[model samples]
Target: MCLLIAIIIYFLFILFLSTLLYPMPVNDSGITRYRTIPWTTLILILINTVIFVAWIGPDMYTQEAGASGTVEYGPSPDYMGKINYYGFRETTLHEGIGVAAFTTFTAMFMHADIWHLFGNMMYLWTFGRRVEDACGSSRFLLFYLLSGVIANVGSVVVTPKLDDIPSIGASGAIAGVMGAYLFLFPGTSVNCLWGIGSLIRLPIAVVQLVTSQQAKFWRWTVSVPAWMLLIWFVISSFIPSVETIRSDQDTVGVNHLAHLAGFFAALTIFLFVRKDLFLRYLQGRSL
Candidate 1:
């Protein structure tokens, strides 16, 4: 029963990804001025990729000891258990304060799988460049790190203290970028690709084989206002968070409170320091 439910959840996640829309500021035509090189965004993507390859990739791809002391590789059955043994945040709480603090930061760089890393980099690339352009590279770097830290802290605070499940990924920080983009480029039109031919095409392709007639795959671009996309994401995160708080469903994955924390942190900062930018953009003027 659990396996069936897992398969259903996986399919639903794939379906969500297939129809998902991403912001494409570059294809926005005259909406945004490409003022900066966005080297900061590129550097971040490079850093995350390198860390994954140098650190996590070896364990993921190469043969290693499993939780039962057996050898395995390439999607090790006990991969999650093994990773949690290293520096996962929830488990680190039992360790000393120094260890817990270190894990909190390290967990931000760690990812569970290739798909997790890829999805995060995609979102970071989508909105990180524009946010970096609005704020200088140095400030953008600071914002990203601070937002991620706050997000983790929020996760620790809101989650059950006894639940020692490890959480790792860049979703919270990328959500912060989306929040900043919401205020900074609300009026900007972003190009997006819709239908099954979207970013996660490989998974959708497999799904097509099982339900060929029911599956409809098409590739096309649509321009949408940035506010609409950002708002939808924030609300989606919020609903799940509320549900989690109200129920004992054992759904311990995806820390929605952290996403909300990072988002609000970025949004609040922009509201105070970059209010003028918001006003100017709202008035249809370039920053």
Candidate 2:
């Protein structure tokens, strides 16, 4: 049920974004151009991957019998609990802030599962390269860490009482990369896969009735402008942050407030330090 609700919410959010900012022309042969090898982004991805492999392992699927006599599926509970010791907790908001300061940086490198690591790395690679090019590698690394720290702080501020739950993942820092990407490459295009293969799969009977041959599922890649994609992401995170605050739920899940905070932090930093890049994009000059 939770998975269903999450899928529905994600689908609706994507639909809404599509309506607001339709994808650009399909560029099957478009190539990514970078001024420098995004060493920082690559290093970040490598570090995160190594940590996950060393500690969390690749297998995220686990099952157990539930009270309803049905199998419940989720990540390994033991690993999740173990990782909390390394993740950022709300108790770090005040009295323990000094002692737990290390967790702010450590949590950005930790992930709960393969999917979590892959998704964050994918976004980081997609957006981090451009931002690194704009700000140079050293500054980019500083920006990424700062954004993540600020994001962790934001999460603590929003859920000060929910200290027992630990938040982990590099998404907050990746969100900052995306925020920087929006300004650095406003006119650039991003490739995204869209489909409904997982939402509704027809049974063999229905498939046979529809066609003699077996149904082959597929998804198409569409290219969208950078600004539109980043804006959609920011808005998506913002809505959830607001909803989470309103409901005051004690769920240890995606930290949307952290994502939002990281995004805004990077945006502010970019504006202050690299305003020229933004102005160049606005003036219709490609970087």
lDDT of each: 0.69, 0.71
List, residue by residue over 63-90, the lDDT tens digit for candidate 1.
Answer: 7688999987666544555567544465
Candidate 2 lDDT score at position 123:
78
Query: Which of the numbered candidates is closest to the native, going by highest lDDT?
Result: 2
159-226 per-residue lDDT for model 2 (tens digits) = 66656578889988888777776655667777754333222333543676578666555434555566
The list of candidate 1 runs beyond 4 A from truth reads 1-17, 20-34, 61-82, 85-94, 196-219, 248-252, 271-285
Please report the TM-score between candidate 1 and the true structure: 0.70
- TM-score of every candidate relative to the true structure: 0.70, 0.70
What lDDT, from 0 to 1, does candidate 2 have?
0.71
User: Model 2 off-target regions past 4 Å?
Assistant: 1-34, 58-78, 93-99, 196-220, 250-252, 271-284
Clashes of 2: 0
RMSD of each: 9.0, 9.1
